[model samples]
Target: MRHTKLGRTDIDVSQICLGTMTWGSQNTQDEAFAQMDYALDHGVNFFDTAELYPTTPLSAETYTLTESIIGNWIATGGKRDKIVLATKIAGSGRPYIREGQPITAKAVHQAVDASLARLKTDYIDLFQIHWPNRGHYHFRQAWNYDPTKQDRSTAVSDMAEKLEALGECVKAGKIRAIGLSNETTWGTQKFLSLAEERGLPRVATVQNEYNLLYRTHDLDMAELSYHEDVGLLAYSPLAGGILSGKYLDGRKPAGSRGTINGDIGGRLAPQQQAPTQAYVDLAHAHGIDPSALAIAFCLTRPFMAAAIIGATTMEQLKVNIGAADIVLSDEILKEIARIHRDYPMPI
Candidate 1:
């Protein structure tokens, strides 16, 4: 597996960061262990999970189950040092988490400590905020993303408080680096500015959804990544299995993400089918798995630090991990560009 320095930091991570959102829900403990062991054996050293995981059926009851499952693996086999652990503290979506509170100093400190306890580790390699407390355009919110309602002064103040708390965690040796998820270009810049001014831990990465169907991070985010040194940890590189052509023609396989989450949090829009088909056809024409095509494309991006991938079964895991070495030719990339122009933002 290919590896790179995470953002401007000295820490090195694999190009394919194993995503663990389906564990403890779609999969069992033994399955998660198998996936982790296989990933580590294959030199995939980075893994990404979140407090709000097993997300197809995200509920208060399933909260922390995924992290607890990883904790079980670490507690049993003692494979902690074999991987770089990255997880997030959820923000403002579930009532059970801090009563659906915003990110603040008290909230951040409390969240990190709880995560450490659950992961059975003394310190996390990278800790991230699942989303900004104020709001963002991710998760198909761009159509009605009205930032005018958000108070800028209040948001900046909250960021400052959270940075202070993160700084304390760094000093206490509880977390090595900090990151953001589901955040916008503006939010990332603001957090970095505050960290620089306040002597807090620098934001090293931003995990967001990036795939063949969704290219939101290609421009503004790419610019921020190049200039500010905060590269993207691209999630959903297969577009929640849409690029695999499995969900096309209304064929929802049993136990798939589309079957469970129903369009993947509004990602399956009314106009998404044609573009999905085009990409799948392109993958077939080149004699490769559609899923691998999508993931390999993510690895080719200039600002992609890592492509986060998940699987409910071992076969899916191998298919994603295999993309690390499959470099798409310029002919394929040019064809992809033509498809993108013909149908942009199909989701």
Candidate 2:
């Protein structure tokens, strides 16, 4: 497992960060523990979870269950020091959490404290904002992402307030670093500027959807990552298993993500099929597993810090962890480029 420095921070994380959103819902506590154990044994030191997890069918009942599962695992042993734990505080929009209120200074402090207690840890290595209060193009909102109505001045003020609260958390030793998720270039830059001006915690990373079907981050966000040193935590590197070709031909396997969350949040567009099949065929032609091919391709991105991978089964987990070692050859990369050009932005 290759490792890299997390942004400008001294902490080093594995190339494959274990994603744990399926726990406490699709999986049991024992299953999550086994996955964590296997990941750590296989050199995956970084784990990413969220407050609003088990999200195949997110509900008020399962809220925070994933965090508690991790906390339970931590309590069972002393492996916390060996792992670089990262989790997110969900932004406004869910009524169960603070009545779906937008993130504020008070909210920042409150969320971090609650997460700390839930994780049963002294501090979190990376704490991220799940999404912007004034949303942008993420979670399939790109087609109609009109940001003209967002109040720029108010947004900046909110960022400053959140930064101030995060600074306090840093001082109190609650969180070591801060990051963003489902955020835009403008929002990331604003947070970075505010942190620099106010001597607050710097933005270390940005978690966003990055897959063959959705390459939105490969454009301007790539440039921001290069110049700003904020690393990209690429999630859905398999495009919700679409790149794996399991959902092709309109086949939804029992208990699969597609079967649970129909169409994967509108990713299964009519145009996505041909490209998905093309990538899968390309992988098979090269004697490579399609899922590994997709994940290895993500690891090749210059700005990628880690490709967040999640699996419902142990076999899937093993294959995903093995992807960290599967170096994509130039031939495979060229084929990928051709396929991507033929079906760019199919999702």
Candidate 3:
């Protein structure tokens, strides 16, 4: 696996981050262990998880089970020092998490302690806020997104408070770096500017949904990433498995993400299917696995730091990992661009 510097941090992480959202849902503990073992054996040293995970059918009961699985792995003599671990504290949305409260200094401290205890680790390599306290355009909300109602001064103060809390975590040796997820360009810039001004923790990375089907980051966010050194930890690079072409022929394979979550979190709308099919066809025409092609595309982007990949089975894990080695030619890229132009923002 290829490694890159995580922002300006001394630590280097694998270009392909092992995503663990499926651990306690679609997969058992043994399956999760096997996937981690295989990934580590294949040189994947970066793992991403969240406080609210195992999210195939997100519920309060299964919350944090994914982290517990990783904690078990760590307990079983897993080499924690060899990997750069990244996890998130969920934002104010889920009722189970702090009564859906916005992230505050107390919330940050509590979240760090909880995540540390669950992960069986003293310090997290990278700790992130799952989303902005206000709201985000992710999860297929871009179409109706409106930033006109935001209160800039209040938002900046909230960011400052969060950074101060992160600063405390840094001094306590509980977290090495801080990151953001489901954030906008303005939000990222504000956080970075605040950190620089107040001498607090700098935002290191931005995790967002970037895939063949979602290219919103290609415009402003890409520029921010390139210039500010806040690399993108791209999640859903396969558009929630739509780019794999498994759901194209109107066949929902048993136990697939779609099978569990019918709408694929609003990603499999009717408009998106045609473009997804085209990309799948392009991969087949080029003699490459569609999943591998989709992942390889994320790696080739100049602003991408790592592509977060999740799989329910070892077979899927193996196929996804091989994407790190699949080098797409100019011909393949041109074909991809053509498809993107023909159908932009299908979902």
Candidate 4:
């Protein structure tokens, strides 16, 4: 696996981050452990998860269960020092967690301590906010998202308070770095500005949806990544396994994300068929695995820090990780661009 600096931090993480959202839900603990073992053996050192993980179904019962699985593995295998772990604290949305309250200093402290205990670790390598309290255009919500209703002063104040809380975490040695998820270009800029002005924690990375079908980040967010030095941790690079071509013609194989979740997190929409087939066909025409081709496309961008890959089965894990080694040729890349124009904004 290739390595890169995590923003300006001294830590070096693998270009392919092992995502654990499927763990303890779509996958069993043993399956998750097998995937992690294989990934680590292959030099994949970065693992990303969130407090609201296993969202194939997130519930009060399964809260922090994914972290517990990882913690169990680290405790049993003694691999804590070998991995660079990253996890998120869910923002206000679900009532079970903190009564669905907005992110505040007390909430941050409560979350960090609970996560530390469940993770069986004293310090978390990277801690992140799962989403903005003010909300942004992600998770297929961009089509009808309205930002005009938000209060400007309130948004800045909320961010400032969150930054102060994160700063306290850093000072207490609870977390090494801080990051954002499901955020907008403007929101990221505000965080960057506040961090610089207040001398708080600087944003290290942005975890958002970035796949062939979802290219919203390609326009403005890419500029922020290049100039501000905050790289993207691209999630759903395979579009929830839609790009594998197995779900084509409405075929939902047993246990597939589509068969289980019904929507594949809004990625397996009927409108996305043509776009997905174009890339899958392109991959086969070039004698590459369709899944690898899809993932490889996400890594091609210069601003990509790491592409997070999740799999329910070990075979899928190997195929996704293999993309890190495959570099698309100019001819293939040009063909991909041509396909993109035919089906832009597929979601």
List the pairs of residues colliding in candidate 3. Answer: none
Per candidate, the number of residue pairs that clash is 0, 0, 0, 0
RMSD of each: 0.9, 0.7, 0.9, 0.9
lDDT of 1: 0.91
After aligning candidate 3 to the native by TM-score, how far in Å is the CA of 339 from where it should be?
Answer: 0.7
Error of 3 at 66 (Å): 0.6
Q: Number of clashing pairs, model 1?
A: 0
lDDT value for model 4: 0.91
lDDT tens digits, residue span 17-46, model 4: 999987888889999889989999998999
lDDT (tens digit, per residue) of candidate 2 on 1-347: 89998999998999999999999989999999999999999999999999999897899999999999999999997899999999988899999998999999888888899999999999999999999888889988988989998987798998888889888998998899999999999999999999988889999999999999999998899999999999999999998988899988989899999988888988877888999999999989988899999999999999999999999999999989999889898998998899888888898
In candidate 3, residue 123 scores what lDDT?
A: 97
Overall lDDT per candidate, in order of appearance: 0.91, 0.93, 0.93, 0.91
lDDT of 1 at 80: 94
Stretches of candidate 2 exceeding 4 Å from the true structure = none
TM-score of each: 0.98, 0.99, 0.99, 0.98
Clashes, model 4: 0
Q: Show the colliding residue pairs in model 2.
A: none
